[model samples]
Target: MGKKAAMQKSKQWNVKGAMRLTSVFHFLQSCGSGCLVPFLTLYFRHLGLTATMTGIIMASKHLLTLVWRPVSSILARQYDKRRTVIVGSLLSSALVVLILLLFPSAGTKAESGRCNASQPSADFTDGSDFTTLESMIIPSQSNVTVYSVNHTTVIMEQPDDLNSTYTPTLVNSSSNWSRRAIRYLRELKEQQEESLHTEFLGSLKAMDAQHQMFFLVLIVIGLWEFMAAPLEWTADDGLYEYLDFVDATDRHKGVTVWKPLGTAVGNGVVGILVTSLYCRTGTVAEFYSYTAFMILTVPTAALLPLYIRKRDRPTSGGFKALQLVHRNSQALLCAITVVLTGIASSAVSDFLLWHMQDHNATEIHMGISLALAHLSQAGFPLYAGHLAGFLKYHGWLLVLAVIALSIQCLYYSFLWDPWSIIPAQILAGFSTGALWWSVAAQCEDIATPGTEETLIRLFEGLPLELGSGLGSLMAGFVMQKFGIKILFQGISVILAVWSITLAALKWKIPRQRRINYSRLLTADTGEISESESDQEKDWLETAMEDDNQKNNWTIAKS
Candidate 1:
């Protein structure tokens, strides 16, 4: 998630102010996102949302990406409104957090699963107290008697408080003692029955209250996500636009590194604050910190680039991208890989916290866990190009991602304590970034000359979102029905099978290396030039053919 991805690096921006402002912008974005995103499931649990409900809410982030990203991109391109979109999104999203904090239904309430014993009512008259021989059977429940004495039973329930006193019916000279006992027993029965009814009604009301807040949060958070969606790609698009304008496109990593750095720092700091301040579930600290960081992001948002990159020709359409994937085997593999990877990653992101929480994990631990994942994920892609270029590790990346995710699933399947889980969190971004790298590299290598843009759109866009949304839904039900351990174990098995299948595919249909094997092997700086990689592919192929021919000749002579 921390990875700004395989998009081209922007040229360096020489202006000091622009660089400073963009750095600050990236920092705040990461800080705000990292501080609270990992703990959101815990927040929902504190608010009494069911596991399935939380899944739907988390899944909305991905599914809704389908709707908002294009809208943001179109507006940014057609109207040159990147600044407007990012600022508006931050403010609107901040407002949504504020609303959730203030909304009463969103606050903590009595759990419906709690057990509350109803009080017992009893009364004894003081006037003319001569009645005696009033034998009582076992205390009655719901007006049913366990024993009777002389065709009458005077059963009295004890109060919950042990200090409360009960008056015994003494011997009576009055003939109406039986009538009095009967009357008093009837009153006690009626009172107990009334109390039971009241409790039943109260429970129903509490359940209604739980459901009311659940739906309210669902709608509000969905809207919040919809508003916030543009902040991801739209803001970067603007920054890259400015970089293109100033011929600083190569400085993309320099400007974008702030997001992951800030996010990592924010997570660690906020987690500590939550721990020290006792900002437990249903608390205000997480939301407050998020709102503050987002508010800080506003000033930086003002200076970001908003100009659209002017294209002289029309790019390939979305439909054309699908047509390419349909015809190309590697492209088809990329699409499937992204989708399945999205599903596994989504399930882990959405519900693994719930699993940790079950083992007594707190916000701080989750924060650090997420911080580690972000740092690890962010670092990989820096060298991913070299690895893919030098060894042509595209197919192997898929294998690594699948196996990494499978290992993660297995680790989580045996999750005992939350602290031990942090180490496993490192795999979180590795698995995702590996798959993204593999798919992106494959799409780039296999695309038709003019259809590169469309091909990129196909693998990165809808398939990931659709898979994420679907995974969340299915995992949610599995978690609620069986348990977290079983759910992850099942996912691990499925991934194991998929990994084997992919291994077989890689064996059967090997992809040609896109980079020159000899040059990268010899470069001292260890820097990979993609341009060089592209130019020398034909040369590498010719050498391979010549070697193969020589091997055949040698074998024939021998």
Candidate 2:
């Protein structure tokens, strides 16, 4: 190839390379969520911030996420997804780094000085008085001789113990002043007046450094987020929403709930194990290991793309292809499960250690309860998804789970048994995951056929986030005042009502839509026009060359 042609081909290769790099970059960047989510509170504590202050800070992030969700989506549609992703991730990273640089470290030490014990006081006399007291105590009978010490008498007094003896001095005037008296008073007074200052700038400097490092980590994370938000919002969110939407309904309910179920269970189980280990070890090392486990789970999130891609692979027949896609769709579901389970497990695990009781029975009771809860949760999505798939009423499953959890919580207020709450936890996981899956699946399906081919997926992530956010905020107040049981009961009633409304709407809404497939398709894929045009141009050029070669051969033969 000529240099120009080679350069053009290289440019095309670079474009492909850029696309591949984007996915990897996004995956690495998203790890920030896992990293920060697990340790925000710990970070604040290290900075000597109070629990209340930490809570406020964390709450601020949640609030921002909620407010920005819709706004971010709108922005994504208005601009290029790639630019948004890169810019958002970078911005967030920068913010995190800046915060690190400015944050104050709490470990600075204060300066202090030593006290002198040998200073003369009002009870003691001048040199003559010391000699008099010595003489009085040593009446001339003993072999003791009172020496007239010269210059100053420097007595290095040790700090007194209770067993030590005490004595007093008496002073008397002599006809002529002794040189010893002048020196003793002058020397001792001079020594007493002198002071030693201990500077502790070293400690202050060390603390500053620590704080800077801590803040830098967070700032780097936040700035990197600037790059992520654009891609996530423009591309991922739509697909996520679609998956979640479909999972919420019967159409895509079969394997969609798997991911959420896995997540709740994974989180609970891992958390329980971590707490137990930490309790035994009684060291922060256990906490670090727990953190490591969470960090390691980032790869799980990245696997979703693989599952989605697998579904898109060529097949021998249309029916078989659909079957394969449907089957592999479960992989995405499973990934979602792992993501949630990992997070919840870590949280619950920490909760156990934080509030564990010393009583032997209490420990056993809590552990058993948590285990049952996790196990029940592990199987919940399977059952819920089955129901959703069979009945074609996935939203109701969410309602059902919510109702069950509320009832159990209410029951706890009236009665007590850790194990009894296990069912509720399981149901909660099922309902939440299934509800989310229903919505996500719907979004994916609803997009026009061509667009769907190029596009983002749907997910219940939004509703889940919204629901959980409300639930968390309320749970805190209810548990603090009315108790855990009352809170659950209240939520159950609310969910039941909502579930009924959704069931009624199932048949009323359109199952399909009529649209210009091409337009919808454009939004689904990467700058579709540019990419498609380039691809078409390349293919046409290749075809034209082949035709020309065929004509040339025919002419030569003739």
Candidate 3:
């Protein structure tokens, strides 16, 4: 009996071990993805692809998610969640590896240096002297040496000694030829700057053979990602269900704390890896390394389902999920808010690397900025539930989120250097964390009957797909035409307007009590004992009466 009891206890502990394993899985996945995906645009640029093309590629992933999400849900319902997760992880990893193997070349460091050299200098203007342009274009410490000998300009490799002697050449000492040469050089410099700027804006001409290959690779990856979406959903649903079963408090902690904390740690780890890799091996090689790391670890998620208890699978249908959106006014409002926030946040996230590079940030600084943003993002959600309580209403949290977003945008617009953007991520992180947390609660409160998880997924996914896709598409065009600074300013203005609209709507709308399983099941289930039936009937009647009274009050006010 003692041995049996010990065995039972050991089995229980082993089952509980799934949670810790899942957390580690989340951290590793986040670290791998965070390192590569965020900097993909910069990698595209390195391959001579324009910003608009990069945006299109990135946007395609989200668009694919929009189409694939419902299918993924259905698959999860049809099969075991673990199998789906394993299949998705394997496919995604394979695709990443394939992409890495197909790349033609990581552009050489010298070529990248030339591209950097073409950028307009800080003091460069139409009226600036040619000497300034020359100084920038031909750095004194460069490996290539330039000298004039016997009326011919000879470019050669630099010798070890800076003071190496060279023959003198005389040019029309009596004429204005030097002035004409300077003018020509200045014109050439201007043209180079213009060409680089156009590339930055994502000109069509930038799509050479190599870039076209990358574009095709991205499309294929997007398809694989779409297919894998269901696996992620399955994993998330299983984890949540398990947490709800084992420890009710942990259900809340999973999203509000553990997930974000894991993400934070992942981001920090990835940031350091990205910096080290970028500095040593360049962007393309770094991506290959990232892919290898991801492929190695992603399969470990398959082991997770073996330990966790499986719950009854939820029914899934695309149309059924779609119908939930029209169930209530609050649901519609929540959808709109989520969509708007997605647009604002997606633009910031997709273009962050470009913005940092434009401001001349080094790999280390870029890593630090990303890590700090994620840390703040993780830390803020811990206080979100408390903040909602203090404000006496969850709606107020949305308002605060808007305020934080506006401040972040404003700060981004004014930033003159890369490091400055790091501190600004605090507001960005807080706004994102608070907004998502409140949105989840709001969606849960307004979920339709028999569609709680489905409605929540829709609420989370639709806006995420549409907003990020549209935001990236629009940002490419806007940044091309108006520049990065103006892009942020415009986003700020739009956010300000959105905040005002949200405030007005919040006051006009009425709040409702969240529907719980007990309330829903008790009301809907038939053939109960007479006393239980009577109790359920009484509860339903009271709820109807309250709803009627609230409706009448609203009508009278209107």
Candidate 4:
């Protein structure tokens, strides 16, 4: 009795601790994301890369993330989720620090000084005697040859002390011919200086060997990012898993309310900190500080699982259940929606900094914009979740997402000032926050028992990986070709078409007929017992007999 009571008390302690730990973990993770991710495009631009190149780099990371999704899922299952999160967070942080150390800043103090001192001198003199001026100017109309005896090409200046009788014999030897020639020489020298400056500036703008090194470092960073992709989804999945041990009401409260609330607070705090740091020191210094914070938080995040009991760890099924998830239609459709949502979100979040910066937004404005968006994100999930419950069809929640996205696109289309962009994020926040909560809950609803983590990861990671990857690439190309406004318009159109199609499909099929969880188990698992099979057959036969009886009754009445 003593041992049993101790075990029960331990379980109670774990339950309470797990809830708080999940919230704290999400908060820290989001803090890091808010500080670094939104500014990445601008960071690349700071490093002298073009929009297309920045997109390519971001796309590469997402592509690697897609490749890593399955691997991360397996790793999470094979080990503790806490272990996976810890290692991934630490490695990602280390890579960020390494990248900063490996690559020098794009514009260094010495290089700036060199660029300044390399300016062409205004006085065009070679400190040579002008007695041979007549020898330098050809008499023929073919060409004027200015020879330099010491290999120093002197500018041809007409001597003001030249005797009026000593007119030089030259082509078109008018009285003012020497003056015209001197004027032409000065113009040529000025042109050369301008060309030199232009070349120097172009060199600064163009990608070179150092830029290639930066690109290579980014690829390495992507590899590190691949490891971190599963952390967010894992937290959500783990929380849902914890719900199995707690009251059902906590599921709604924990997921919709607490999780987003924590994320909002973290994002808001980080936004303020980022704004302050960026205003004082600039982006590079701010990035370094953020990375340091991320590194320190990894250990804090790792402490979560220590408080979680073994019974609270997420259950995993073998590879067979993993295969079963793919055949589940509800899961498939949910995954597709998530993918589309990811594409839309990535296009905006990844490039919002660049978009606002184009409109002359200061760092403080950018931080406030992101903070406000996250705050909206924090507040809306519970309401959106409640609204989803109020509506008969959960699928309509997606339609709401589509509407929110459309509003954001419409608002951004007309926004000419940076601060004006902040208000648009209200829609963005609702769209993204709603989609995230809805997709997770929907995936949980459809997940096979013991395969919850696997399905959640698939639903969360795969769609986001592919959508964000493709979206970043597309956004880069579109923005480069047309502009930011056109890109948002195009995204809006695609989303409109997609949402219409989804709505039509949803309308055609009643929600009750959409997914039969028992059917998923029987069709996928092949593990039904004899009694369960017998019960299924009896139920089917009874339904058929009832249909026949009703037909017979109708005939008799007629």
Candidate 5:
């Protein structure tokens, strides 16, 4: 009796630990997705990369995910989840840091100082000297060359000097893409610096801020794994991971489906923790802000599992389930948001170009937009969670909002001739909130009854990674190939189809589950306990269904 009681107590403790771990997982996931998606364009633009190259580079990450996420999922099942998470986080972190390292940052302090210095005085002995200096100093991104009388030229090397142009005669066409981009960006940067009052400066600042934010996100994910993975690995998985069927899927094959709601919650709490820390001390508040948003990642990663489960559910007075609902709905909404934003980006950039004489204004405008998008998106989940709580609607509101936003996109695309895409962009800002909510809610709903938590998280992420990858690439391609008008039209069409599909599937289940606030506690115990056999049975049944579904699937991998 004594041994049995002790075992029961242990089980309870494990459940609590699992719950806490899951929340942390969710926060990290959110931060991961939120920081990257809104700012990838800004990062590329800041690097002076053309839209096409930016799209390709962004697509590369998705391509990597297509290979990596599934492999990671398989490993998670076969090995310890904690270890899998840590490995994934660490590897992802290393890759991120490496990618950033590949790019130039503020540079070394000494280098920065030199770059910040003004151009050297030029000899005014001859008029030809001034012309030569203008030609040399205005073109090169790093080194400025000034020509005086008698073929005399002075070269100034300053890495940060926007006025310093390269030796025009020496800029070979054979130079690599990065060098060319860096040169171009520096030129753009110089242009912006000349005019600090224009809207363009804001945009540049927004982009710069976006790039910095992403770098920080990568760092935070690494830190999370460093701090939380070992404890999670050691924690009891009975109430969460074990309950979700760690053994059922073919480790080598098709998609692994499971809910990861707990992970999302964990991420949310982490965000809260960061907020709290910031409240306590202002230092590193931005880092705290970034870490706090970690919650968004879980839903996107586990989208497939959530959709599959959604597919299997009993219809409310049932019509045939809408095939390809997930793709159509999400794609449509996301496309609309991007297209509208693109148009706005163009119109605004153009307006700034025409009206603003200072480059600094352009930089600041871009920076503000980038920052606004991320900060708003970071707060999205909390608002969504609150809405879900009040309305008792899982993700219905988010979907509706997306649809509404798409309509607004159409309004900007069609009716508002001279208003700029600003109005549409204002609406487009809601896309992340809607999509993230949909992803998270879908995971909660569609994942098998008792196994919703694990699968939700697992499936939410992959889709976001994949979707954003495709979206960013497509956005860049469309923007580069066709003007913003065509891009807006394309996005409208995609979103229209998606909305129709969502209206068709239209499964509505009344919210009945009570919020288990106790689940938020970090202890190793919950309010209830169940036998090991029961937990095993729950997992086995879910896995069998999942396997059967996989056998029947014939569609392409999105």
Candidate 6:
């Protein structure tokens, strides 16, 4: 009896130790990822990659999540190297990023900085475009405004709609130009920033080096992203499983909260660092901080348990989850809503920072806004139950999420100043939090006996990733062709329409609540129900285990 008590004490100690270690690892990894991810668009832009190319790369990363996580899960279970994989991924990613920093093409945009000058023409009365930041340095002497950055001359093409395009080009100083005297129409440069000799799209000949560099970057970053998603999945799953085995699932919330706290802190700090570096020497701080944070994470990750915690019950595969969804009309409706939500979610993720910067948001402002985004949903989780009860069903809550997304999109469309982004991010975070719970609870409701994890995965995994990837690609093309404002405005309209349709469908479909068999997750393969009326009811229903019971698995960081 004394030995048994000692064993119990030791197990208790292990649970406490695991929680502490898990929290530290989560914080460190999240901090590193926070610094790394939100600014990828900025880095890609700096590399002179077109918006379309950048979009493709971002989309590829999201899509790769489905492939990488399953493979890593297999490796982890087979090899029993969860800790090794996590630490190794952190180290390997740092190395890849450092090597990527050595590329020379990121400097090309800064080499000949381009801005569309509204005042270049004498007839243009409005200087509203230059209200805050000036990407263009208008020469005091020359009537002909060729684009220049640091006195380097660049070829310019005037667009019929300047708002539609922003191809950064620089102007040459008047003294460096050997100009033949034109007797007529010398005032053309003053009237327009376009050159008649050049095409509206400009020459693609010079972008060869940039294109090659971007392709290489695309390949490298895609691989990096492929490795990245799995590590996060492994880490989070490992922690949850650890907590489950120890019967310490109650501590899950306390531990996972650190991720957002770390994200908020790291994002804000890195933004300041980037701004400081950019002001002094025009450097991107994410390159340095990202590597450092990853390295810092190595020790923390190493301390996390290397072993996988085996669950007692057998869970159904994704096939059974799909079968359930096919049988249930409300589940089908909710699944469709999740996909549309994912697509809308991608627009803000890929381009909000870019949009903020376009309107003169400094790195600090963008960072704070992003940090706020992580924390915005923090309080919402507390009210998850209340919100669902008040709305009377998870389906309505999901419809509300779609509506929240639309409202956020509309806000983003009208945003002009940097400070306004904070509230916008807050709204995004809350809506996303609402969406996660609503989906999780609803998915749980529709899941029959065996399809718990599969149902959540169906709602949360590849479908969402697929939607986000496609959305990123679409956003890039739209923003590139029409401008960021138009992109947001159009998306807002689409979301608004979807939200209305979703609400109507949800209203028509009655909510169904399955008995909470998952809560009885136990080691008994003897019977799913310690007591149940029908055996056929439980034939499809087995103990799915605590792992599948995890709600809030989707869009936790939105």
Report per-prediction Cα RMSD to one decimal: 12.2, 20.7, 10.3, 12.2, 17.2, 12.5
**1-558: candidate 5 lDDT, tens digit per residue:** 999999986764453344444444444544443333333344345444555555556555544554555454444444535344544453444333333324543211111222232324322432453334433234433244434444443333445656665542333323464355446546765886565556653533434433443444344434433433332222223223343443422221111111223323333433344334533431133233333333234333322121011123232211111221232343333334333333333332222211221222232233343334345544555566666677566555555655755565455445322234344445543664555556545544333333333433333334444555566567667767885556556665666666665555544322223223242242232222223333334444677889887877734332
For candidate 1, write residues 336-454 as lDDT tens digits.
76788778778888888777767777767777887887787767788887776775566678888888889988898887888898767788566866776677677666554445545
Colliding residue pairs in candidate 4: none
lDDT tens digits, residues 1-558, model 3? 999999987765453576667666666656656656666667666665565766777678778878786666555655655555555664575465456435654333233443343544322323433221224343322344333333333344456776995443334523465445445555654565467555753443334445555566576668657655565566666666555455542442453344455445545555566556654555554455455555655656666633344555545433565655565556577678777777877778777677777777765666667777777777776677788899998877877788788778878888788788876876755687777777767756655544555666776788778988888888877877787788888888888898888888878876655544556576653322223344345566788899999999999999
lDDT, each prediction: 0.69, 0.39, 0.63, 0.62, 0.41, 0.69
lDDT (10s digit) by residue, model 6, range 227-327: 56667767766676666666665576687578887888788988888777664544457877878888988887877754464543333366667766776
| Clash totals for all candidate models | 17, 85, 0, 0, 88, 9
**For model 5, what is the alpha-carbon lDDT of residue 457?**
33
For candidate 1, what is the lDDT? Answer: 0.69
How well does candidate 6 match the true structure in TM-score terms? 0.73
Off by over 4 Å in 3: 1-15, 87-207, 210-214, 223-230, 240-258, 277-279, 296-299, 306-324, 448-450, 515-522, 525-558
TM-score of candidate 2 versus the correct structure, residues matched by position: 0.41
lDDT of 3 at 557: 100
User: What tens digits encode model 4's per-residue C-alpha lDDT throughout 120-237?
Assistant: 3312223643233433343211123343333333333345454633322434333365467656755654555456556754333343434654566576667657656666545554
Model 3, global lDDT: 0.63
Candidate 2 lDDT trough over 10 residues, lowest sum: 108-117
Question: Candidate 1: which stretches are off by over 4 Å?
Answer: 1-20, 103-207, 245-250, 253-256, 279-282, 309-324, 382-392, 447-458, 510-558
Q: Assess candidate 6 and give its lDDT.
A: 0.69
Off by over 4 Å in 4: 1-13, 76-88, 91-95, 101-210, 233-267, 274-280, 306-331, 510-558
Choose 3 or 4, whichever is better by lDDT: 3
User: Which is better, 5 or 6, measured by lDDT?
Assistant: 6
